[model samples]
Target: MRAFIGMDFDKGLKDELNGIQKVLKINSKKGNWVPSSNFHITLKFLGDISEEQVDAIDRIIKSAVVNTSPLSITLDKLGYFNIRSNQYGVIWIGIKGEMMKLNAIYGIIEKEMKVIGFPKEKRKLTPHITLGRRVILDLPFSQLREQVDHELGKEFLLDNLTLMKSEEIMRKRVYTPIKSYKFNKILEKNHR
Candidate 1:
């Protein structure tokens, strides 16, 4: 089965993101825009893993997340990945807030996952959710960035990390969380 690890968005965040996507779609009119149901923050992309691998991954995640308290991430800015010369596609919204905590969890997952065969990421995590692929618009992506560059409606509370299953239905990819591992460890209260 195809599987990976990621975090889901709340309804309000999803709605807000959908509205942003709506405007981008209307403006660009050319791109593989992600469906709202498919919106998520990918922590790790495990292309295809066996059942045994899935079990191992679940164990790794559960063990690692137990030490982690809930984290908050904000929607910071609009950005994109360069697809070709002068064409920067793969539009996305960047992350902010409680980033150190997020990075710590990512590091733990990377270290454990690598022991089982997953390759370590060459580049550091950018921490963004892709909104569109192969995007084409009259103006440059830099120009578009200026237009949609706004702070988040609210911060995201990540109480859990998920092991997700990826499936193709009617020629479209659908992501569903098979298991969720919550971070229930208590943090020391800060005293003034």
Candidate 2:
């Protein structure tokens, strides 16, 4: 099955990103825009794994997230990623605010999943919500980069992590949540 671990967005946050996508579409002439309902921030892309491996993955995820607290992530900043040889494959909104906490969660999942034979993440965890994917690679990115308005400044509480199944419907990719794991959010405020 095609699978991954990710978090869904709240309605208000989704609306904010939807607004961002609308703007991005207006500026760029070449890209496949992501559907509003498909908006999510992936924690790990597991690719294709067997059902048995998924069960094991679930165990690892549950253990890793135990005692983890909810975090507030603010989505701000617009950026594009280079896929290969000057091809900017994806445009995303960068995440900030409470990133250390979010990184802690990502690290726990990454480390524990590795123990169960999943390959370790090669790159540093860059938390962002994908907005659009490039269809044509020949366009000058610098011009398009300047055209996009990237500051989104939307914040929301993230309380659950989900293991998702990806499937294509009507030529568009759709994500279905297989299982949802709630963060046992610690309520203590740190005294500094």
Clashing pairs for model 2 are none
- Tens-place lDDT per residue, model 2, 1-192, is 899998877677788888877766766556788898989989999988888897888887787568777788877677778767554599888878898888888898898888888888999998988988873434465665554444455568877788999999898899998877777634322211
TM-score for each prediction? 0.88, 0.84
Instruction: State model 1's lDDT.
Output: 0.81
How well is each residue in 1-192 modelled by candidate 1, as lDDT tens digits? 898888877677777788788767877847888999888888899998887787889889898777788888778888788877544478888889999988999999899999999999888988888888888776776767666766353687767789999999998989988888677744223210
Off by over 4 Å in 1: 85-87, 151-153, 185-192
Best by TM-score: 1
Q: Show where candidate 2 strays beyond 4 Å.
A: 83-87, 135-151, 185-192
List the lowest-lDDT window of 10 residues for candidate 1: 183-192
How well does candidate 1 match the true structure in TM-score terms? 0.88
Best by lDDT: 1
